[model samples]
Target: MAADVDWDPYYGDRRTVLALVGLNLDAAAITARLTGCLLTDDELADGFAAWPGWADPFAGFFPLTDDINPA
Candidate 1:
């Protein structure tokens, strides 16, 4: 599963990020977060209906690094 994730942008490195996410999670917690408040199978169906393979609903948490301020 980690192989499928490319989290370097936020994590700086996939291994480091995977470790961070892993520290806060176990199988049960991962299941709960995905099922309880964050995203459920049904919700994912609807969320992904707009686009096929976009991952991470919270990706909008960070603004594009390339975005510039016009002053």
Candidate 2:
């Protein structure tokens, strides 16, 4: 599921969102750094909780040219 995400000032793009559903601390940490966030375990959990209904936890960035199908 990939729909328009809230615009992030740091990333400066609505499509610059990524989620790691199940990863170890090391991998998640690396990914967070790559994604420009130094998220704590709680923060990551919050992200999952706050995720939009139209988005999937495993979905990567979706370009504007693509269609978003949450189903």
Clashing pairs in 1: none
Give the residue spans of candidate 2 off by over 4 A.
Answer: 1-14, 32-71
Residue by residue across 1-71, what tens digits does model 2's lDDT show? 34436556754555555655643457755575565544466766677556454335334543455555544
lDDT of 2 at 34: 68
Q: Compared with the true structure, what per-residue lDDT tens digits does model 1 show for residues 1-71?
A: 56556556643544422333434347775555544445455665686565555566546644677756645
TM-score of each: 0.20, 0.20
Lowest-lDDT window of 10 residues in candidate 1?
A: 16-25
Scored by lDDT, model 2 comes in at 0.54
Q: Evaluate residue 62 in candidate 1 and report its C-alpha lDDT on the 0 to 100 scale.
A: 46
Maximum-lDDT candidate: 2
lDDT of 1 at 38: 51
